[model samples]
Target: MADETRATALRVGASEIRADAQAKAEGREAYAADCYPQGLLWAGAVRPGARHGLAHARIRSIDTRMATAMPGVVKVLTARDVPGTNRQGIVHKDMPVLADQKLRYAGDPVALVIAESPEALRAALCRVEVELEPLPAVCDPVAALATNAPRLHEERADNLLGAAEIRRGDGAEALASCDVVVAGEYSTPVQAHGFIETENGVACYAPDGTLTLTLSTQAPFRDRLEIAHALGLPFERIRVIAPCLGGGFGGKDGATVQCLLALAALNSGGRPVKMHWDREENLLAGYRRHACRIEYRLGARHDGTLQALHCRLVYDTGAYAHLGAEVMALGMEHAGGALSHPQCSDRRSVRLHQ
Candidate 1:
């Protein structure tokens, strides 16, 4: 009987094959990174030579002479070459497209080297020597919030980005009336979105002053706005085309290679420029889920009915505020579990433990 059922299911499935299955099997699907044109320029970012510091890297000497003199070498452009605003970000314009002042993180881009061949681009990036004056780094969030800690952002007092609180039904008063109370602490680890294809894209500037981008992005519509605002280009001048992503899972929800690739394309002189992050580069530089520390307290009646509930959630946003506060807010909202008792005086009280 089981074999008959399986056979019937197979027969039904055969007529309803997925549309993407045939194209994938035949290798006909076109991914964004696969859209390479003739005479394409290769672009790569020069990562920090060291770790954990205020990266005061000066372009005192970029010995690109060897790279330029080499076969199939184009131009090695630094922050000085960026025609518009060299900064890029989603909500907060804190990140620089090319690091001009000091390298904030180890993965900050110091130079954008364009070459006729991928091999030449790699060689040129290696030859670029960036002299950096390292400053003390605040690796820990708690230490970063300390009064005397080195400020990551000079405009802010400490490293505290944001804080929020929610209250309902006099939780403290109701907790006193409860017969039983429970308290505990919990912590969650940082999660990585291991997208299969990694982050990759291709960008090209047309002769008509239009910048076109084909990228692995989830928010292609929103990416246009961010690119225009960051690069100081007209919104109509930028066009973004999103293809079937290898995987996004929220990590690619914001600006990744869109802005940098756009900048590289603009400097490519109408030639298409490609940027593909290998496995290691993606893991090291890609954004991850925010790590969180939570404290929970619950008050209950004698019948195991929930009375008052309170929780404090703290999240390590890490460098930028990439939906960290929203994630914490969602976690706080679910702190009461699934059940709610009317006999209980207090229903919910959740606060962001900044």
Candidate 2:
């Protein structure tokens, strides 16, 4: 009788689970992309073609005549259309909202086009002709540090962005006093955030001249200030609302869709403009973790008492200085553990490899 009861219970449980699963099996779940508005305009960016190079491409001639004449085409704007500062950055104002003079990376934006229909937007994007002058590029950070390397920013010396160091005792002297020592090299690779949603947002300009933005962002509050400053609009004039992000992983901490979408909304004629980054665009244009290389040396007494330590850390900050200095500083702080000896030697040094 007990065996019979157990079998019946198992059969009932399976049926219940099947019933719950059937709804999803028939495609009952709804995602955000499934929703459509009565009137929607699609907005997108025209990224630089090269992976790394000097961006001397000037929009020498925009044949927007054909695009504007196309059915459902709204407006085509360039960097010159930007009325404000035209730059965006978290701690430093370096990145351009729209490349007016030069493109820093291959994925940098050169133009923004808005159209009544997705088909129209696609046609307009293709019709837009850009003339670019290709300059020398620095692919490796170590190569960028060479004395003869091309400068990414004219104001900076070489490609080196910044450096940091920490020292305690006489690390060089302690190494001589120690009987045993170990030297090694280590490296870390770049990691992606891999958020499911990628990066996306919608922007609208109200009749009263207020810009409202709904985006999948991590720092919605800071984004508001950044957008306003870059667009040359009053901070109060912009209202940024963030929803549950698909995934961020610190990649979206700075400008992603905020400035571009805001510029789209400004030229959208009070109509809402939406920008959604596809998987390829997200991968190519997205910010990544700093790749690092470390050289370390440790010395100890014959009896195994730690004596001296020295290290040199090199961080590859990629094209832009996105949290590179801060990341290197953190590495320098953790290079060596706490020590208790009075005459012990410890030193840590960091170099930014562009």
Candidate 3:
């Protein structure tokens, strides 16, 4: 039996070892961040500084003269430079590639600076000056739902991104009649993916206008569509090559560096353009797990059998709607908890501006 088990373990298809594990352990596995093509340019985003304080604001103007005049600085592009709809998302076609009229969040990129070197790119970005008109901001998800609250998106009449309710039986009536009832409120903070790789990608535009990108992204196929839609390029002309990622706990499952790298490549005069987000930028601009507040009311019989459950889930989905609706729907689906109950009432809402 022992000999047979060893033989099975040695079989090609039945091997217990991961094929890439050895390479990765020996530092021989090449990730997207390791790629450095010849004649590569560096691109960086200029976001609202800490001095701005407020996340919500109007962009009065972006003065790129200083950065444009700096040595090795290639070009400073803003939202106007983006060709297509300038929007990218999975299901919701929101989130601007660059902030145009409004700076939706403190980390919102207002300008893209391209340079011959990473040092030049950072220096140039620092030289770019922006004038903003501060807008009334909402920090609380519940407060953002108030009618008197300032609107984050003019299109969205309210800060509510999505809402839904699930009902199985007469939960309200059942709760009142139960022999024992308990209530509680639970809250969770916004969580970062904290992937070791961070967000980085390299893109090069061919003479024929074909754009190719090699990135550490979890969604390479979807990235092609996102790049095409955001930059007005033909979907067929875009190619995304996803390499072995160092880490990506759902953080790279969305846009991340896809659209930005493509846009930088387009303006790099056909040279390969590389954009890498450092740890700080990753925390500020990365897609994060939603912060949630949940209220629960549980009713049980004298025998300790659960009779009814009522739950209200509210999630702060941040400035942009990145799978906000789907996130809320998932929470609603699981509001009943692990134990089964005959009656359950679940209400969920996804809010923005957090």
Highest lDDT model number: 3
Ranking by lDDT: 3, 2, 1
What lDDT does each candidate get? 0.73, 0.77, 0.87
User: Which candidate wins on TM-score?
Assistant: 3
Clashing pairs in 3: none
Residue-level lDDT of model 2, residues 1-354, one tens digit each, is 999976886884364345436654676643333334557788878775543244433434445566667777788778889978998887767788877766667778878888887777877777666667775777666787899987767777778888666777778888888899899998888888888877888888999889988888888889888898899988888888775456688888889888999999999878888888888888878888888888889999889988888888888887677677887788888777765466665656555545
- Runs of candidate 1 exceeding 4 Å displacement: 1-17, 49-71, 339-354
Error of 1 at 322 (Å): 3.2
Ranking, TM-score, top scorer first? 3, 1, 2
| Candidate that beats the other on lDDT, 1 or 3, i.e. the better one | 3
- Model 3, 1-354: lDDT tens digits are 999988888888774878899999999999988999999899999988444786899999999999999999999999999999999999887899998888777888989999999999989988999999999888889888899998888987788887777877788898889899999999999899888888999999999989999999988999998888889999999999988988988888899888988999999999999999999999889999989988888988899988888888889988888888888888887778774765544344444545
Q: Candidate 2, which segments miss by more than 4 Å at Cα? A: 1-37, 50-63, 303-305, 337-353
Q: In candidate 3, where is summed lDDT lowest over 10 consecutive residues?
A: 344-353
lDDT string for model 1 (89-154, tens) is 676667777777665566777777778877887777777766676666666555666788766566
Better of 1 and 2 by lDDT: 2
